[model samples]
Target: MPALFVTGTGTDIGKTYVSCALIRALKTRGAVVDAFKPVVSGFDPKDAAGSDPARLAAALGDPGGVFRIAPRRYLAPLSPNIAARLEGETLVLDDMVIDAMARAAEVRDGLLLVEGAGGVMSPLTDGETNLDMIATVGAPVLLVAGSYLGTISHVLTALVALRAANARVAAVVMSQSLDAPDLNQTAQALIPFLQGAPLFLAPRGESWDAGALADHLLTDLRAP
Candidate 1:
């Protein structure tokens, strides 16, 4: 099965939401799809149990076995490096990437959706960023662009970074849950702005449907 890395223009840009949607969609297509969100920074004491990885686990029906499903939870809600520092931990890029890749290998025959922390340039360590992690995985990226004003610039900027890093652009999905004022016009313009790079719009409160969403993903991945 092909692997995909889901990232976004910035944090809270709906990367996790889209990741879950893809996992659900892959399941619908009769594929054994699994996800891994390595290096999540930011923790809410109140949400001691509401971690992104934990939430992802829940989204995937909380399957057993930690090899391929565990989310590498980091406590700071900040960038990985900052969070690591705050939590008295060091950001080990090699170790973290290796661990994530090992898990992805375990599910070699299944689609693996690896979600990145923060935006493309968010620092992961003293000198590293999510860009390095994406290179290590070497999977095509599916950038999640939140549907908001000025998204075009954000998307374009992110696209440039992804291309610079030699990461393949599977497609861009515009998440409509970001509370934008002019949702319609923004969504309408995204299509032509992307210029043939297929774009999909997701509305708020949308039921997480794997089957329906899979079609859109397949089109973006161009997988038969």
Candidate 2:
């Protein structure tokens, strides 16, 4: 049951970036890891290599992992509900993703990182949000947020939403954004709101000590 559901305040908030970093970091420690992105939109089969699942699959050491990892792939850059509908398909969240996550959890023991699509409130289907996905998995969350202006409110709001869903937060990463209201300042302001969850500030680009963060999570999560 060692898994982390990496979700963000919104799309493109570095959830995939943090997930891949943690995957590589865990791999470096000789840990068995698997990443699952149940649904992905804005995906073009022609450019599959550049998709999020493709990148995650690469991190999992599988080049063509997209085929096996994400079962629901949509063409449009919209929400999964719309994306699936546009393709003449319907995404019943439970039908499409729940059992897949359950199956992935059963087979993978080391670390299963379930990367959710879009923000917590983003539509996953006609009736579900990413929050429902997190609730369905019941995995500890590693909330990813950016340091841009208004992110303090965004992160806190996301955290509150998770709290409302009764999701256990494993950790939080304030992934640096290109624009900002100051990284450290934003992080400082967020500390008291986490209800004791640890927060890490990652560099906007590479050079983030993802391995260290990985180690911390492994150690901390396992703590008695």
Candidate 3:
């Protein structure tokens, strides 16, 4: 099975949004898709309806459950390591890798989308970051960024870190942020810094559609 690891410059940067849209787009192209958010913090099992995992399940048209989508859930809205420690738990990188592999196997020949928690350097366990997870999974990346001030620096920094880890960035998506600069201008500004990766602008508000973004992504993925 093939997978795309969806990561971001930082949290709240629309990783889930872009991922959901990508799943929809892939499905529209007759691709069977499944999504995963391996480690999720700020989760309340009592109110799983509002969590990222639940939202991803909904996006996959499987709103009935979330545990299958995100196996690890922590209560605190902090980094995974701290959150796990707060609950007297520890996250093992190998266990996470095994879980991801198992889930990927379930997807079989379909596309398995893995949504990383927070930024690339966000700690997963004591010494493991999301970057480590990406490396362990050996999946190409779909880096997501926000159209906010100083976003270019964050995006570039993440790109450098990922490159250092030998991760392949398939594309970059600049998601529109509230009260932020113009998305088009933001994307244009990033063009020079993007090296050769394709740059996409995801507009804010009513005009946003995951299927449309997926079309662009599929086109790129199919390109030689």
Candidate 1 TM-score over all chains jointly: 0.88
What C-alpha lDDT values do all the predictions have? Answer: 0.74, 0.85, 0.86
User: Which ten contiguous residues of candidate 3 have the minimum total lDDT?
Assistant: 204-213
Clashes of each: 5, 0, 0
The residue-by-residue lDDT of candidate 1 on 1-224, one tens digit each, is 45788888988978877777777777767777678877776756466456667667766787442324544556566787887787778888888688777877877677678888888888878888888889877888888888777888899898888888899877788887555856667877767766566676666653845455577666555565
Tens digit of per-residue lDDT, candidate 2, span 178-214: 8677889889988988889889878766556698789
Candidate closer to the true structure by lDDT (higher is better), 1 or 2: 2
List the lowest-lDDT window of 10 residues for candidate 1. Answer: 63-72
Model 3 lDDT per residue over 92-205, tens place: 999988888888888886778989899999999899899999998998899999999999999999999999999988889899999998888888888998889887777765
Best by lDDT: 3
Ranked by lDDT, top first? 3, 2, 1
| TM-score of every candidate | 0.88, 0.94, 0.94
**Prediction 1 global C-alpha lDDT:** 0.74
- Count of backbone collisions in candidate 3: 0
Q: List the residue pairs that clash in candidate 2.
A: none
